[model samples]
Target: QGMVGGMKIPLVQRYEAGFRAGVAATNPNATVLVNYTGSFTDFALGKQVGQDLLLKNTDVLFAAAGVDGLGAIQAVKEAREAGKAVSVIGVDSDPSHLAPEAVLSAVVKHVDLVVYEAIREQRQGRFQGGNVSLGLKEGGMGLAPVRLDFPGKDEALRTVEALKARIISGELKVPTQPAPSGTAGANP
Candidate 1:
């Protein structure tokens, strides 16, 4: 698998780091190649990077480069059309609608829930004046449905649910920073 990012910004870093952590947990022997386009809106650069990663023989690509991500998705779709067994994972909002066949799934942020919580807190006089971090435990974010059919789909979903449960229960902690290569579960 591989990941393409827009830049080395904090938001992109978080996404890349989180993805690496997940890959390490699920497939310890898997190799995760990463690249950055250095521009969030450069679709051409994203496509070039995506094609480069595909040449490395990645089965899946995670596109977390904002608008640039769409180009990565397009690359995957074109590859699929040529009989390549490749898929993409979108970030932020669902991109499955763009290319249902090439998109495997997406990472969805529950912004509505966040807004509702903030409003409810303000109404209850419990509003905090600082940043609030929420994850699976607080229903802040999650993976969208798998749009493409693949073998072991059921098993994969089951495993994902189990891992999510562990995360929510505090049994497993996901790091916000990238782990050193060859150190799967190391924090920091």
Candidate 2:
């Protein structure tokens, strides 16, 4: 809903909100930093930005970039190789196999389900052209399998499940837009 390093997009805002929610759920004082990779296929730029962010003490780097995401994986791998503690969460399909040691998890977007639903709707005379929003509760998307090497893997799974339940039950309504300054009660 707003410009982030000239990459004005919705995904970054939503992902930041989700990360903020996680921080609130676990550590109230956690600091979350976001870096934007303007080019989707610029893996080298992604790697450079990722390494710079890691140098600044970012504990986790979530790369929602397209193919540039692979660059972030490389950055994490290099950092870990150099004996730094860091992890990354991939977007779209599961890319954990690309860097098993650095990838923590992935947000798997189910394009197939969305396509199927669209076809079904068309068949039933209910197709629409507007955007469709899918979240953890929707069969349209879910998290990929978590890597085994993550130290807090169990707690992370529990947290995700709890958040998913809250989201499904409408107890936790994630913000789709950037909130106004000075809002306190809501989690991101």
Candidate 3:
């Protein structure tokens, strides 16, 4: 797996942490390679990074670099067109529409819903000024519907739902930070 991020911000780090955890849980033998482009708007750099990762034989690429991620998605699309067994995971929204052939799914963040709730609360004299933690159970973050046609997509979706339930029930904890070096899901 390859993960390309816009920057080393807390949000992106959290995404990486969750991604690494997911890979570890699903395929313990898999390795993750990560890169930070520093700038969130550099499409060229994102594409270059994506291409480099693909050259390393990454089966899946995760793009969380804002607009820059579009370039990574392009690289994955091209690679897939060239008959490479590769796909990309989008972020922020369901980008499967952009490249349904190459995009496996997305880690969607319902920012609009959050903003709407905040405004509604403010208008109702119930505004709060603090960070709020929301996850699958709160309808804040979730995986987009997988659009790729694969052999075990149904089974995979079922497994994902089961894991989601465990996470919501606090039976499975998705790490918000990468583990220490040499540990499972640790950053390289």
Summarize candidate 2's per-residue lDDT along 69-143 as a digit string, tens digits: 778778888888888878788877888888888887787889999999999999999998998987777777788
**Candidate 3, overall lDDT?**
0.87
Q: How many backbone clashes does candidate 3 have?
A: 0
- Worst 10-residue lDDT window, candidate 3: 179-188
lDDT pick, better of 1 and 2? 1
Q: lDDT of all the models against the reference?
A: 0.87, 0.71, 0.87
| TM-score, per-candidate, Cα-based | 0.93, 0.85, 0.93
Candidate 1: which stretches are off by over 4 Å? 181-188
- Candidate 1: minimum summed lDDT over ten consecutive residues — where? 179-188
Runs of candidate 2 exceeding 4 Å displacement? 1-6, 178-188
Alpha carbon lDDT at 128, candidate 2 = 83
> Distance from true position, residue 105, model 2, in Å?
0.4
Please give, for residues 123-164, the per-residue lDDT of candidate 1 as tens digits: 999998888877889889999998688999899889888988
